[model samples]
Target: MKKVEVIQDFPEVELVGRKLGPFKEGEEVEMRPWEASVLEERDFVRPVRDFSLTGVRKALIREEKSSRLEELPSSFYRTVSREVRRLREGGEVEKAEELEEAIESLVDFRIQKLARMIISSVDLGDIPAEEQVLANFLSQPLTVWEGSIGRVFEKNIDKEVGVHAKKVRRNI
Candidate 1:
């Protein structure tokens, strides 16, 4: 983030700095005239999109092939299990549902990706958010992992819970 110039008494700033017209370091730009200020090209701050994330990590995992996808759902489950255990151990069941939701989304992501149906798996209206936003960088087969392992991931996602298990296959 660039250093924010504090405009005195305004207590608010125009988005993209457009409303601050004809600014020189010490100029007092009138708020009313600032609304339509055209910013010079030099004043524009380019937005960054990290393209490495979605492609690299996904490719790395896919390179591991069936073994990786087979391991992934359990891995997600284990991670959630560990966190839930900690939360429950710390006596914070009040927030368990939130944690569960996060786990579901993650697992569902893998399931949908492997299923080659991410378009229908999640709400499309959700703009890509997170490190995985780089998914566009991936190739097709790498973008969507398939095989018996996908079925395994699908099966593992709803694995039956033992009497003392932390997870249960009860419908979401």
Candidate 2:
């Protein structure tokens, strides 16, 4: 289950023998992913990323970055980024700041993980299944996913080819 904020009013919904809310716009609620998916498909709600743990969140980001073998859904990161900005502008400055920091940390962690994956995939001859996936992800031109973190990944990959790679490699 995860937290999601309603973006539109919805009548009460029953699921698993329990009644959920007649949710209003801007209302936050806990929901199972399957249930949330129904609302999300209609653009009625957005998932709230858990940003409570700096280290754990950063690690998760690293794992996600390294495991990608294909493109993500179009709205995946954009929705989270938009929600963070919304929270920041809606008077939740402290929480927004925390989420923003987590996002930055996640980006950094991802860069480091990609750098390591590049090195291992190129130099180690044969690597793990996940590393192969990372390698495949990197094989695509970053421009294929315009306006996304693919640009950051591309920049990091370029850097990893030189002295900066040495620095990023150490972190991984």
Candidate 3:
């Protein structure tokens, strides 16, 4: 297989009619399978905006989060959800511990929609209007249907669940 050269590259245009610049050499741009994503809401559209490092960082974060889930085996989700259901009505101590774990796992601005409902009583300070909109959006239920770190632990509660990767067998 030919290796895609490490270079700066992006789609030519954005949905908002913005054009991206030509990639410079020596920059690492992802050219792997499923490298690009498409958002189909209307007439053919793609996110092809020219952005600074922040834009790239957001894209990379989104990609990394997606990749993390995709690398897991099929049986991961059902197992975790079952465990969550079992632990859902756990005692105060267990609930507190799970809450701590959830909070610790949250990113800088990980605002769940349920949190917004509770936060609505607080006075809006000097936060920007745009950020407030995002907060509102985030207040929606986060129904993430995918493999997660907690799932791994829940699945192997009785025994050690080592690394998942295994050697591929050839039939030839």
Name the regions of candidate 1 deviating beyond 4 angstroms: 1-76, 117-172
Model 2 per-residue lDDT tens digits across residues 56-85: 365455556665422223343565577677
Write down the worst ten-residue block by lDDT for model 1.
44-53
What is the TM-score of candidate 2? 0.37
Question: Taking the tens digit of each residue's C-alpha lDDT, what string does model 3 give over 1-172?
Answer: 1122223433355444544324344443433223233221321222333222333345335534651211222332343344445556564457545533542333232333224433453443433344356555654433221235345545554255344322332211
Candidate 1 per-residue lDDT, tens place, 81-115, comes to 66667777888876565566555544455544544
Off by over 4 Å in 2: 54-172
* TM-scores of all candidate predictions against the true structure: 0.25, 0.37, 0.17
> Cα lDDT for residue 140, model 1?
46
lDDT of each: 0.41, 0.64, 0.37
lDDT preference between candidates 1 and 2, better one: 2
What total of clashing residue pairs does each candidate reach?
1, 0, 2
**Between candidates 1 and 2, the TM-score winner:** 2
